[model samples]
Target: MNAALKQIDAWQTSLAPTLPTLPGNDIDWLAQRRSEALTQFSDIGFPTRKTEAWKYVATHAIAKTTPALSQSTIVDSTQIAQWRLDDCDEIVFVDGLYHEGLSHFTANANIDIKSLAESFEHSPDKIKALLSQDISDANDAFDALNQALLRDGAIVTIADGAVVERPLHLLFVSTNTDNSVTPINNWIFAGKNSQCNIVETYIGADTTNNLTLSRTTINVADNAELTHYRSQRESKQAFHLAELTVKQNRDSRYNAYPIALGSAIARVNVEIILAGKNANCTVNGLYLTKDKQVSDHHIKMYHAVPHCTSDQLFKGVMDDSSRAVFNGLILVDKDAQKTQADLSNRNLLVSKFADINTKPELEIYADDVKCSHGATIGQLNEQSIFYLQSRGVARDQAEHLLTYAFINDVINRIQLDALRKQIAALIIGRLPDSEFIRELV
Candidate 1:
């Protein structure tokens, strides 16, 4: 067998002993599902560059390491306080296990928030019904792996006709203690006519090479509104892969913002399905990488019903020998008349060796649909830099300003004031002459 298959077999061997100890192991349905998913993962193994969906990023570093379970590391509130948002309910997970001691969230009648293990143990029937659902026609090896080892995560459910005044934040932290791997599977249900905002952040220490495989399944009921923001900041030696699949009902609105930074290799996949008439969604993203880091984003927006709409905007900045990839697709079904879809990807390279590969596609089977897609890859305009330099700005500062401005288009879409400012500062601090731009941004 090849090296990739051998690596996967090793992982399966290591993972077998721990399956019976998981929360829902005794449930036959759940056990069968886990077994099936594990078999699927074993058959496919780790994705290689030959995989069309993962052509730009590599998995050798992650596959070579024997996967171990994540353990808690020493991290004080002060170290992570900056990542939190004020006036919000928050839950903290350390190494994939819910850390109730460090978490703070008020009890509300209209919402139910609990860890996946706890929820499964309390009500296995409901959890089983919901967890059994997956993306209709998508087969992903990471997602299958996540299912095979899924033990703990978060479940957020909003009551019908309820409006949550405060946003909900889920923080997943990986300590820099060992070469461990964490698989997180989250399920979110928004009731009819309900409204809520959610923020999901994945962060790791700078000293470890951890692997985080996470997948979020969101079900939006009719006329519900959900705004989601996800940010990733991993160590230079770490590998991160995340998948977000959202299903929207009639007259519902879903907006998502994803920011990627700080990892040797990171890939995010987002799939949004408009399953009901008049459902709509917007996706905005930003990624910044330096050194030998690689960041990638893939998006698929499907309009399966009439009168649905979607818009996608993604931007990236690369320096040193870092590389980035963006692939977005907008699909309109045969009966989906009056569908409106748009997609755009823009990238700016700050170093001569930095590279970007972008593709924006449109697949429409309906004649009445309006679909458009485009991608732009280039460096900072010298004329614009000269214009700023002529106005007393130094060359380095001018370059920094333009680069900051290029990424700000996506950053500005963040609705939360504190999160937006913090992300802007983080992005600015990664550029040359960052201090000067920090105060200016």
Candidate 2:
């Protein structure tokens, strides 16, 4: 405890310099929340493989180094144009800091975007309410740190009953000068009866070893709908960690699709709270790891109100000496009767030395509620392989096609066809320079 406390103190002292230098804005009110978050991070500095949620994942490579911050890299229009999605608005952040000149968005009367540091003066109460609402601060460490030392990030507000037809892209790009850790925080709000879709992408430098810590919280109001996708493609030596928590209101829909393909060590968390009756949620994810990398996904779903429903599916593929982990928990409260929830995890090992671990949990208190959990860990079916090979498919091509089919289920579930294709291409693009991806249908 004392050691953690000291670490918190160090974080407070070390990160003070990075705080946004702007005068009175939302950040002033956010100070207390940040301190509390720092406290939480200190109490849980780095989770080890022994931790129930981290058993199959070891974060030693990430915990051993605290890289110094570098001058953030800026993405110009040419670079931004590379990621243009169909019917989308883009907001770019370089190395956790806002790159105003590099970002472009059409002005909408009802929608607004401002830096956390710059918007402090608009509404102290609203800002304070934003910081600590919807989250239980005791269980998470990195999330707490995000609250404590977070300097700047995007704050998006959608007006009541408004619908954003275009997707909002929150892009975070890293530049390599050294092995510094960059933390990016995102705060989002979907008003009552509003609709929104957002994408958060993390990119790393080509040469320098970079580490990114990202946190995002979304508030879905009554009758609102939110669709979110996060893509992580950090540098080869980079370490990436991110957490997403969604709070749902009555009759609201919150859906998330997270696809991770880069980074040496990656950890992602998804927490969905069904706070209102009749709410619905779906948490879906896909990840692929190669060489000596590691990736993990942890999910928690809570049915606190009656008439709520949740479904979760996570899929992963590991090749070479890489490793992947999936941990999911579903909880149904006693009074939350008529609740329906299910959790499933499917994984594949593409190489003899690759590793995979999966765990799905269910905690139900109501007798009338329905809940179930299942997980599967296996390699490609040999019979299917034999049939394909016999049908004139080469050995490597057959293996690659089967592997693509294994993960294609998750791809097919993505609501956005373009995003699905982008993710598929990313996975195929990294196919070890072999014939594996070329043969996939």
Candidate 3:
């Protein structure tokens, strides 16, 4: 058999025995869905270079590793203390399993929160309804595999016309270094006219060589507003793959900020559908990579109705032999008139050997729509660095300053003060003379 086939066989042989232990396995409907997903995954396996959406990046490393499903690891609160954000309600997941002892959040009347396992036990009907929804338009092998090995994740629901005063933090940590894979599925629903902020963070121990597959689905009701932030800081020896899907109703608003800073091979796919008129969304993202790491971001904005607007801005900074890819598309339906959409991707190659591949696309069937897309990949201007050096700044420090400035635009868009500061500190720490630059910022 070929390498791809071998990988598929290995995965099926290893995971088949554990199917009975998965959450909701006992539910006939859920079990049937899982079985179908597993069959689909077995048939397609992982995507190869021929797959247009995954053409720019290779998945050979993941196939070769073929990490098994992750098992729960004992993690103490102090072990993840540094990752906790202030003034936020936190939910912690270790190795894809919810850890109630490590998670602390206050109960509020306007919002209801539960783990996927809890929902399976107490709210199986709701879970069945969500899992049975149609996602054929964007479903892939990775998504199927996540469902096949479904585990625990957060489920958030905001009451209609209510406002959540504090941000909700969903933190996932990986401490297993035995070549394991963790699958997480999160659901968030913003009721009509409701407002809330959510943050999803993925982190790992330094020596990990694990893999994480996470999927989050969100729905914003009429006139609702949601601010979502995602941060990926897994171990440099690990692999991370994630997907985010959002659907908006009339006059709903969505603001997204995604930052990628770690993982040996990391890929994130984001899709937003404007299902109702007058929906608006803005996405700003940044990816910083060094050494031999790889990062990829794929985004799609679908304008299905009239009078919707979308704006996307993504930036990347690559150093050493690191590589990054950005693929963004804005699609407007034939009847979606008066749509205004724009996409921009800018990348900086900090080292001669660093590389970046960016593609910004627009497909509009509407005649009266306004749409634009562009991409730029280049190195920092030597003249700008020369000017900084002439101003008494060292060469290395000048480069660090310019690099930091390149990603600060996206960082500045984060509205959460505490989270913004924490992200800033993390970014600065990655550059040379971080202590010196910290004083300037």
C-alpha local distance difference test of each model: 0.86, 0.77, 0.90
Arranged by TM-score with the best first, the candidates are 3, 1, 2
Candidate 3 on 1-441: residue-level lDDT in tens? 987999988988887777788877899878887778888888877899988888888988888886778998999999999999999999999999999999999888888889998788888998888887745343478878888888789989999998998999999999999888899999999999999999999999899888899999999999999999999999999999998999999999999998999899999998899999999999989899999999999998999999999998998999999999998989999999999999999999999999998888899899999999999988877898999899998998888888887888789999999889989999999899898787765
Tens digit of lDDT per residue, candidate 1, span 1-441? 878888999988887677777778998888877878888888888888899998888878878887876766767788778777787788998888888877898888778898998877899988877765666443778778788778888999999988998888899888855677788888889999999999998887688678888888899999999999998987888888899889999999999998899778899888899999999899898899899999988888989999998988888888999999888989899999999998888889999999999989889999998888998989999999999899999998999899998887789889988788878877877777988887676
- Give the winner by lDDT: 3
TM-score, per-candidate, Cα-based: 0.96, 0.90, 0.98
Task: Output the TM-score of candidate 1.
Answer: 0.96
Q: Which candidate's TM-score is highest?
A: 3
> Where does candidate 2 have its weakest 10-residue lDDT segment?
19-28
What would the per-residue lDDT of candidate 2 be over residues 1-441, giving only the tens digit for each residue? 554444445655655555443234235456556555655676677666567666777766655555454456756667656565666677878777888887779879556777765555666666667764647444656666565556667888888898988788888887755777677767888899999888888876566577777778888999999888888888768888788778899999988888888889888887788999999998788889999989988888989999999988888899999998888889899989999998888888999999987878888998898887898889999999999899888777777888888888788887776677777777767664335565555
- Screening candidate 1 with a backbone cut-off below 3 angstroms (N, C-alpha, C), the clashing residue pairs are none
Better of 1 and 3 by lDDT: 3
Ranking by lDDT: 3, 1, 2
Q: Candidate 2, overall lDDT?
A: 0.77
Off by over 4 Å in 1: 136-138
Worst 10 residues of 3 by lDDT: 131-140
lDDT for model 1, please. 0.86
Where is model 2 more than 4 Å wrong at Cα? 1-40, 121-125, 432-440
